[model samples]
Target: MGLSILGLSRFQFAMTTIYHFFFIPVSIGLALAVAIMETMYAVNKKLVYLKMAKFWGKIFLLSFAVGVVTGIIQEFQFGMNWSNYSRFMGDIFGAPLAIEALLAFFMESTFIGVWMFTWDRFKPGVHAIFIWLTWLGSTLSAIWILAANSFMQHPTGFEINKATGHVRLRSFMDVVANPQLWRAFPHVIFAAVMTGGMIILGMSAFAMLHKRTQQHDGDKVFFTKSIRFGAVVALVGAVFATGAGDLQTQFIIEDQPMKFAATEAIYNDTSDPAPWAVVSLINEEDKTANSIEIPYMLSLLSYHSTSGSVKGMNTVNKELHEQYDAKFGKDMNYYVPVTTLFWSFRFMALSAAIAGLASILALWFTRKGKDTLMNYRWLLWIMGACTFVPFIGTTGGWLITELGRYPWIVYGLLTIADGVSPTATVPSLLFTNIVYFLLFLLLGAVMIFYSRRVLYQGPDGEGELPAGKARAAERTSPVSAQSTGSVSGNAGGTERSVALS
Candidate 1:
């Protein structure tokens, strides 16, 4: 790979997007789940359930803080590294993102504060209302961002600015009504939900393990329910991800055939019985794939019918299309990462399938009317696996979707070459990237440590410690004597919660 500012920008873009998404998906999914759990607890008047909701909400708060911090970098990168691409597509792209800021982000930021501190001050009914609103805000925040991204993935109805030489908005309705928005939005939300389920399962597993082995029955009762709840969500969300993901995949294949062909490394114009590239260890120079493939899979998937021709990269791209006809005109440096995208996409899909089945089985065993408590070992195993599956699936899915786009920053509207900073060379960009990457790594580490601290201090719905404990503990700095009262069984059984507040 030759070094170029565009290439470095791609790497930087990839790194930042991956990091931002890591937090956003989990926050969206977990926030919804937290709201639902709290609502159920409020109606049922179950203290344990309420306690469980409070515990998970603490973790959600941690993830939300990190999500917002990292997300700001995404908007910044557009101007800093991808200025030209932004200038070209901003008129079109900025519309939804701007709306996202005003409508969704503002709602999320404002009410989250209202929800957070109101627990002690407000009535349960009022607080629940705020919690529901918080969930609504997060969902809308995701929707608007996805709308902006979907437009980039598949540009739709827009007019050009003759004066500015940039694509401009003709109608707001067209931007909102873009067909890609319908496909991309649901897929991303479902993925977010899946990511949330994983975290729930993973944390609950740790809690379960801690409780069961040590015989902390108080925590186990709530955490076990948490595991069951997480499993159900994971199973459903994984299926949702798959269904929505396939829809977009099919759309991409049908509409962007050359894009699809290049994604699969089909160089020659081959007709009839389109062979699927499965598990190819390809030599780029020779263009030979020495790997196995199940024949006819691609044909069935793309067309919903077998025995049809799927054109290769060279044949379709070489055609002398009407440059005057393609509304924006076809001018692009043809690029594709057939091997990387193909495998990454498959890995993501396959992992989701595994996670879904595992979760379903776990849910089945868990919901067996108290009998499931006998086979606690299986929940423990599945819970451990559930925690990491979403990460793998998300990372893989992103690699497929983002890398598959190859040299385009804005689908057909802009190329990666045009997006590079004119004054900066590859080395300069690389230097900046190294600095950014290291800073990001440090930031992520601090966030994780802070999250762990938050989890340790919270999960208690009833203010367990005395009100004065915080002040006394702060003055002493990480060391506190036992309460003035006699030591009870509670102290022996439960570890002290280190309050972040």
Candidate 2:
């Protein structure tokens, strides 16, 4: 059967949101990486760091451009496909989104241009400030956006307006200070860092493989340092992402028990020392799942103890039905998509673990100016192939976040059906969906094409080095070149001109 209006609208939103989100982390990650690389160049006055900053900055620009285009479309979706949601959430959402636009987006956009064009105008340390500000603006943008989303996950700082029957903001501070927002904010930030780090690490590995064949000693030094830098960033991000994820899970156990239960595929109430499911064959129709269990792990996961029992989906469902059915009325299925959440949670966890593992291996192998990584061609190939690993985890994590809150667009406040625009038709949704898919496909292809083109060109290639002054710096010592800001600026100017063109 064809999808109904609700189904099609939801699908379209889901697909578009996911696609938009895919680039967001990459932009955020690359921005911070570029900022740090530039800062290192400013501090140590190393031309190698300058080369890294310039090369990666191009990738960041591409990602940021696509992210902006996709994000603009997302804003329109609220009014076009989910007008009711907009009406209900207008008051609560307006402040943060406005702040994001007026303060964060403006700050980011303004400084990014300054950073790009003024590379030749400012001193190294002074020039680095612009990219740092750009990172701050982007991070702040995420914070405000997540504050609005957190309200949907766990409604706070709002009251029902009796006259309009819509939610109005009660305290802006409370909304921004939401516990859920903080939990989710750090998790997302760290994940983005990991995503960007993986990209750098993977690209470096790919370059190393090619550079070895061509016997380019300069390129070898560039990629080697880059690989180590990427490894450190990725490892730190993975560690923190995992920790932040655990905190989110703990919060979920308290604030959204149904979601926790669904993730574990638990149907029946468990004993005091509940076993954690390793894998489950979920039968949603029968409200049953045959799970491969780890003794006392569920208790540990839920309560951080091996003794306490947690409510299962069946129990949570019964309680929710009793609480909400009276107001919303009858046949309310409280059970979420068990199979989806179960695997999504696992995939997200596995992604983090893999990132952590790869990073540690990278660090160990390349310790103390060692060229051990060159010995493992297989490992380099694998690292290059695993560029998309963190993306998989991030996508799966979002799926669990959105889907686990089934039937409700806003927890305990609005149903998905009520939030969807009642006037939206299947035909319009289908047409938009097709258009979005094609548009995203084109953007993705362009991004990949340009990124590959950059890699193929190599770091020492044309436009990477400017004419007279940059060549003069190459002959001078690294420390001596610190005083030669004009020479370095010319190189940066060349990169900016190439990237922008």
Best candidate, TM-score-wise?
2
Error of 1 at 87 (Å): 1.5
Instruction: Put down candidate 2 lDDT per residue, 413-490, tens digits, no spaces.
Output: 888888888889888988998999999999899889978766655664432345675466445422222333221211
What lDDT does candidate 1 reach at residue 135? 72
Worst 10 residues of 2 by lDDT: 492-501
Q: Candidate 1 at 359: error in angstroms? A: 1.0
Off by over 4 Å in 1: 211-213, 262-265, 268-277, 319-333, 369-382, 425-428, 453-458, 461-501
lDDT (C-alpha) at residue 379 in model 1: 59
| Model 1 clash number | 0
Best by lDDT: 2
- After best superposition, candidate 1 residue 156: deviation in angstroms? 1.7
